[model samples]
Target: MAILITAKNLKKSYGKGKNTVHALGPIDFTVVEGSFTIILGKSGSGKSTLLNLLSGLDSPTDGTLVVAGESLNKLKSGKLAKYRAKIGLIFQFYNLLPNLSTLENVMISSWLKGISVSKQDATSLLKQFGLEHRINSNIKTLSGGEKQRVAICRSLINKPAILFCDEPTGALDTANGQIVKDILVKLNKEGMTIVMVTHNEEFIPMADKIITMKDGIIESMNTQISK
Candidate 1:
């Protein structure tokens, strides 16, 4: 597979001098195209920090990060916004507007990215996720699983080159989490490049690569065939 993301001694720190908090690397890693990659660690392990850096949510204090041929660490605000549009983001908490219907929630993401998505396409995505019946329901009225499925549909509406997820299934119950996990696996199998961070070990075995972190550093990395 081709390299879709590459980091070289990537690092992030906050504050300055004596009060500084070194939150993440001085680390290096690569994500290959069409691979399911997981970054696993407990809270404060810097997994989220790594995800933020990877997704261009924050810039590195030092080192380099390149995704989809653009250097994230070096991009200006406008360029960074453009880079971000090429990716999709999902989080533990479904970040949908409670006032909006499921269909509206999905359509909004494309609008935010400067792309106009028709209602038909958005509905099709929701229908494919088994959420056809709830597409007209307000997010506040939907169950947790329904809310999350809407989030997934919203993320995909832009046709992002990479999907970046942070604890995607962490907020769901067992059955719902399984549904989310299965959907993710299905997406990866269908050629979505996914990079997810979570505290759950259950996701590791199913991924093409696993990066384990502890205390803001890599503890180990393993590669295996996708399950």
Candidate 2:
């Protein structure tokens, strides 16, 4: 598989000198195309910081991050915004607008991108995730799992080249987390490159590659045979 992402001595920090907080790397890693890769760690391990940088939500303080041939640290705000639109993002929080219906939440980004997608196009994606019945449901009415699934649908709205998930199943129960995991696994089988950050170790057997972090640096990296 082709390398979809590469981070060379990538680092992120806050404050300076004595007050500085070393949140993340100086870590080097690569994400293979169409692979389900996990950044696993305990709390305060810098996994989320890495995800933010990789997803273009934040810039690295040092080193280099190249995703899909674009050097993220080199892109200005305008160019970064454009680049972000092509990348999918799913958060632990659903981040859906409460005033909007489920379908509206899914289509909002597409509309913002000026993409001409009909309702059926959006509906089909929701339906594929067993959300057809809740197509018009309000965001506030949904459960955690339902909201995450809707968030997943919204992430797919733009047909992103790579998907970045920040603790995607972090807030869900075991069953719901498994459901989300299965969905991601299925999507990976269909060739969507996914990078997720999590503290959960239960997903070890499900990963194509696992990047473990401790105290803002790589603790270990392991590649497993596809499950």
Candidate 3:
């Protein structure tokens, strides 16, 4: 498989001089195309920081990060924005617009990208996620699981090559979390590259590669036989 992401000697630090805090890296890894990769660590383990760098949401303090053929560390602001548009991000909280209906929430991505919003496509995607009946309902009225599903639809509407999820099921109940996990696994089977950061051990078995982090560095990386 092709390598979809590469990080070489990546590092992230906050503050300067005496009070400086090293948040991540001085680490390296590659994400295989169409593979499900999970970054597991306790809170403050720098997993989220690593995700931010990989997704082009933030730049590394030092070293190179290449994603989908673009060097994130070298891209200018405009170019970086363009690159980010091709990547999807799913947050822990259902970051939907409370006032917007499910369909509208999904349409927001197109609107932000200066592209035409396709209700048909949005509806189709939502329906695929079992949210067909909730399309017209306000986001505030939906359950946590439904809201997260809507967030997934929003993330996918632009057809991103890779999806970056940060604690995707953190706020859901056990059953709902399992539903979200199943959805992710199904997407991976259908060839979507997924890089998820979670503290949940249950998801480790589902990933093609499991990366464990401690303090601010990778402790171990385990590759499982893909199903």
Top-down lDDT ranking: 3, 2, 1
User: Per-prediction RMSD in angstroms?
Assistant: 1.1, 1.2, 1.2
- TM-score for each of the candidates: 0.97, 0.96, 0.96
Q: List ranges where model 1 is wrong by over 4 Å.
A: none
Q: Single out the weakest 10-residue window by summed lDDT for candidate 3.
A: 109-118
Encode model 1's per-residue lDDT on 43-146: one tens digit a residue.
Answer: 99999999998888888889989998889998777887778878989989988887888999999888888898999999999999999999898799998888
Clashes of 1: 1
Q: Among these predicted structures, which one has the highest lDDT? A: 3
Which parts of model 3 are misplaced by more than 4 Å?
none
Clash pairs for candidate 1: 11-25
Better of 1 and 3 by lDDT: 3
Q: Write the per-residue lDDT of candidate 3 for residues 79-189, one digit (tens) a residue.
A: 878888889999999789988999999999878877786799999999999999999998899999999999999999998899999999999999999999999999998
Better of 1 and 3 by TM-score: 1
- Candidate 2, 118-173: lDDT as tens digits: 89999999999999999999889999999999999999988899999988898999
lDDT of 3 at 182: 93
